[model samples]
Target: MSAFPAQPLYLVANGPLAGRVSVPGDKSISHRAIMFASLAVGESRIEGLLEGEDVLATVAAMRAMGADVARGGDGVWRVHGVGVGGLLQPQTALDMGNSGTSTRLLMGLVASHAITATFVGDASLSKRPMARVTDPLARVGASFTTAPGGRLPLTMHGACPAIPLEYVLPVASAQVKSAVLLAGLNTPGITRVIEPIPTRDHSERMLRGFGADLTVEESARGRVISIRGEAELKPQHIIVPGDPSSAAFWMVAASIVPGSDIVIANVLMNPTRTGLLTALRMMGASIDEIDRRDVGGEDVADLHVRHASLSGIEIPADLAPSMIDEYPVLFVAAAFASGRTVARGAHELRVKESDRIAAMAAALGACGVACTEHEDGLAIEGTDGDPIPGGATIATHLDHRIAMSMAVVGLHARAPVVIDDAAPIATSYPGFVAQAVLLGAEAR
Candidate 1:
């Protein structure tokens, strides 16, 4: 594993960017596809799977838990499941690398089984809060011995004859919700979760695809999801669509720099994950959806984007859950828009691999963009297509989103921007540099 040097990017003003590129598979779906396949009764095949470190961590953890998962020729992956309630203890600790998704989801999967497993990660992931999952899972009779403040490098003790209960999510988190549902798979009766705000619903959709009895209903407070316990999950093939989060970088780039036309193909159009697109549209970005189709229970479409003048608007806090992963790039887009863009209700951004809100604010400020930071969000004043003086070096803090977001800003900056570490980009989106270069972005 080689470390990526402190690469700086240079983008000259006024170049037409035109190309069609397909980003890697959806990170969320890729993680769930491997996990569900590993728990099914038969062999499961996956296509368009992300080979990023996050998804690979799930694959490795599944293999450690007694599943036969392997890569074949033609870029396909196969996983032989151990059936429900058949996970065997691993001989070593499960190293999740930099993936919070892998660490949190696997904790739920192993919580109700008859095994004890320790989870570890890189420095950034170890700092993220895990109490969201551990606190709720503990109510269902699972026990954990974690670091102070419920951080990682923790051990999960499974609850045999697991207790199934209805849990209400205090915050809008898909990981915490999914963790409970995964644990419910081995428990008896029904396990329910009430979400105040709708997060990404990949787990619910995928679990239903694997033949689990899962149901969603709207309530006065919010949405309620119920999963029946002790049910057999049928194995099925999954085709992962390109990640919209990864596509966000190109989308923002194509929107701001003049005379740029780029098409992103076969990207996931899940409503729960399209907040970035919606926010961009609200800013009058020249983006269109083309050749819509359905693939493996997900909506897929090609995004045709062209450069256009953008005007900023206030983004509602409720929309945060859908595009939480994309705020970094969204902030970059706001820096060049016409007015002040205010984003609220984003407390979740604080606990990601890095504090995304703070990171974006700091980076944007360093680059001569005026931004007002909030406890939960930020207010950014756009320059309305004027040249932004950039001459600042950004510390990515080993966060992939931070690195990519800064690169997007360089496309319109007065001077080139430098990021401390570009190495972390491989954790979720490999070939990021090549994809950006194909779209007329210069990276050195």
Candidate 2:
């Protein structure tokens, strides 16, 4: 395991956080924008793209694979695609760092092309499961020589004449769905994915916008997404909206902290990814949507959040796919609420960069919060108005979400909450500490 500073920062409960904050661009959309732009026929300009390490890794990989990609002024990135089936083999191993999304999706993109590539990553990413993408891609004639148990540090040999197959997602994962669709880009005929539970639809929406022949049909089982293979994708300008996941941290912090009211601007309110907003509303958060509009095919709105008395409610299992990444922060909200909050149908949490369910439970327990962790989910019991005793040091395990979640917990704790390592926060949210400080969160 990589070791960093375990020295903890103390957070004294402060007055209401009053400010307007704009989070960075969506990480998922940023990754796909780079990937799709590199595969399109012309130059694709992207504004408001996330420049985090994870997305930067995608940029480096694209450039290594012979795509012209560079950053211009003010979060603007330009990528010139070689064509649909025109990717060159990389000279070195593609390092995906801590991004599971990048690793899985890139595996799919390289799987159907006529090149061979190797993928490596940091310790946290090396442990993440790759079987989710590899198994499905294998069904469509992509071959992999992976590390034991389908971990990273593996080589993938793309099928020259790729096979097209129908895939039914075993879980509600946008990564899995995107992987199959990307691999199908170089194959012949229609490549279809059946998602019983819809995850984030950025890949589908963005793909359709890029001039791909993509179709979606709703059935009793779930949503069926079909993409025609071997079509030339026309590059276009893309404007990424602020990540709702990143915005969620500030929303939770502002809501539970007394006298706090904050507005997050230009947040993507895609229904497929708005379960946290809905859950917060159910728990008595005074949040309002204002100036709703569409930007680049995503629903954009300003969220007005104010402090209110919150009571916990059972989170529906069906909503897991929508806000999977927000659960750790949601657990923070649960700790400060009244009554019990139970989260189910989150077995996928175990396969993330870390076992997030177990990590959150352990960290919360360390901070004097009562929590019960299951194989898939957790149950958190709130102390009503009692301050959470937070004089504990929790191990972050090099997971960015874990670190950020623990920091959120510190906002309302009687004492300061300290995380063992804050280093991993750079993977997705590079300016997390600065942004949190601006929002009146104390982080050292």
Candidate 3:
């Protein structure tokens, strides 16, 4: 199926960016809010929800299962749920457009419910690995008939009163962990997940807020999370904070671009998602925090970033689970630093919406930045704060982060940077072009 328009966008070197911007609500939390609210007994109200394509796919799927989900004129989303184990068998397939989270987590939610649902996705999502999720759900009595290699366009028949067991994660993935937890909500007995390394805890936090009987404890090995099944979730009023991942673009853009001073508002500063900030500070970025406070159940802050002469540093591998989504743009920041930057233990990038390691390496090579791609990471030699040669059109293989990362590349390049298609950005940040223009990015 066609993914994006075959159009190109050019970004010329802009002047200093000076402004404050509030990015959209956290995409991860937005998806969970819709899912959890749709499972609660009473009506749940949500504010600051991300209206991006990915989250809307979750809403559409939930609505297909008989939940009354709608946005009122007052700008609040209200969902009257069908309760746990009350999900109806969809009359048609769930078209999860370009969203791995919606597909995987919904599969878990649909598992153990005695319903048959078919799942399908766009070309890019279809190519992602699904065995990581399907294998675990299979152990819980959910049978799947998938495409080759356990990919999407598959049908799942969930078992009522499914069996529960403990699972150890071979890789660090919040998506997989969340899927199992969502599945556990409808099964009998206790389901346990032993994470090798902790990923984003948004699912755990949101699930707890919705009254799921879940507990997370740190053991010597890793985190052991146990959830009591057949949960009776109560409705909640949720106020989602801004996405730290989306604010990453501005963080990198302001750090390297000359004479730039920008502030990102209402950013989620949860410890699990602040790896990009920590890595940037290690590279000597001039970032300051103001008006820090707690909102809903997460930490929120306003970040004031100023242009700084950054030097490359070794990114800590332990921080990979926290900053996985921000690595592509972090690679862009590494391209402008003064020394060699080494990012290792991030093989997860290989399986993202695109092969981010390969994508960034190729894009940087086209812009005259020296980079070497490894099996797990990237090595980049920066230009010592000088403008890079960038008179090339980089191909974005339907990855939203790739397109946005290259947009930051144009800010410090000697020549304009052209992208093959920026339409994919609508998946996460719909107002990116306008935000970039407001922050002084020359685009046409």
Candidate 4:
């Protein structure tokens, strides 16, 4: 657990939410930008990076490994990279905070370099399994000593001239795939990954943007991605768009709260991250795309969402990978819909910051919403637009999405809902409550 004290937030039903708002930059892109820039041969400039604690952990880790990283008064971040295979051994352990993305991805980067580093994190992060990453890296000649259950507070000894090999993903995890790809950056020869199920392609896109010799080919087995190791990477300017995950809360909130009409600007519309938008649309949400365009090699658009009568529908299993992070809030939307919402094929949710399936089940039950938890997903019987009983203090379990999702539930509930600790929300959306209040929410 963090040393910080728990900060509770009370939220009650409010009037219509209105106005155009912008969320922070994409966390995934922000982390990648910092990482790729730190591996480039020259200075790289980044615009609109998310300053959240999670992304900052990546910044601090890169700096500790000899990258010159700083944010100027103009709010632009500049990084002077040490080049591929040039990372210096850190003087101390890398504290990853609550970012699993940072810990896993960085483990891959350090695997093929000639350095040894220790990684530590907060209690929540410490419990997450790192073996998925460490296992593949071990095959690449890197060695690790981890806590029991392959958890955090671990040491990794990077391999010099690491061996490159082809590996297949047993699960559909972008993090694991990205880890292997990143480790390939400093290895000799070519590293290949056979992905049976497609996940986010940010690493592939950003890697190419930084001039890494990476290629993707479709086949009967799935997508075969190959990256030539020990290649020179050139620095470039990067602009991060608004995170769709952050925008998801507003999308669902506006859908459930009567009379809500809000404009969310600069949200990334990458197909891999738009499953929530697609899912909500299937549930009869009134969301319109405004000025869809490309920004920084990715699709982005402003969303104009209005309150509509939502109907529960079976969530497609294939859509899980695209909107996994948004499930908590999606459940909130389901709670107010007409009919039943059944979600399956998302067993991956069990190992997140918390068991999201179980967390949402207990939270909704506390608010008098009926839900059945499954090993893979949940089945929720909606109130069909009626406000369910609230007046409950929800345990956030140090999970940001749980806190924010409950806050949304409070907006349409019969009574106020108290979040046990809103502090975790800062790890991703620091201004969530302030923005909620700005949109006419009765939160304090």
Model 4: residue 118 alpha-carbon error in angstroms: 0.5
**Please, what are the lDDT tens digits per residue for candidate 1 over residues 1-444?**
224455554444348778999999999999999999999999899999999999999999999999999999989899899987999998899999999999999999998898999999888998998998999888888899998889989998999879997998998999999999999999999999999888999999999999999999999978999999998989899999999999999999889888899999999999999999999999999999999999988999999999989888999787899999999999999999998989878899899989998999999999999999998888999999876889888988889999888888888888877877777899999898888887776676
Q: Taking the tens digit of each residue's C-alpha lDDT, what string does model 3 give over 1-444?
A: 254357677766458888999999999999999999999999999999999899999999999998999999988999999999999999999999889999999999998799999999888888888999998999999999999978889899998989896889889999999888888999999999999899999999999999999999989879999999999999999998999999999999999889999999999999999999999999989999889999989999999999999898899999999999999988988999999999888999998889999999999999999999999889999998899999989888888899999988898898888888888788889988889888887786
Once model 2 is optimally superposed onto the true structure by TM-score, how far is the C-alpha of residue 429 displaced, in angstroms?
0.8
Best by lDDT: 4
- Model 2 pairs whose backbones collide: none
RMSD of each: 1.4, 1.3, 1.0, 0.8
> Which digits, one per residue and each the tens of the lDDT, describe model 2 over residues 163-229?
9879989988999999999998889999999998888999999899988999999998799999999
Worst 10 residues of 4 by lDDT: 10-19
The C-alpha lDDT values of all candidates are 0.90, 0.89, 0.91, 0.92
Cα lDDT tens digits, model 4, 284-312, are 99999999999989999999999999998
Ranking the candidates on lDDT from highest down gives 4, 3, 1, 2
TM-scores, all candidates, are 0.98, 0.98, 0.98, 0.99
- For model 3, what is the alpha-carbon lDDT of residue 138? 94
lDDT of 1: 0.90
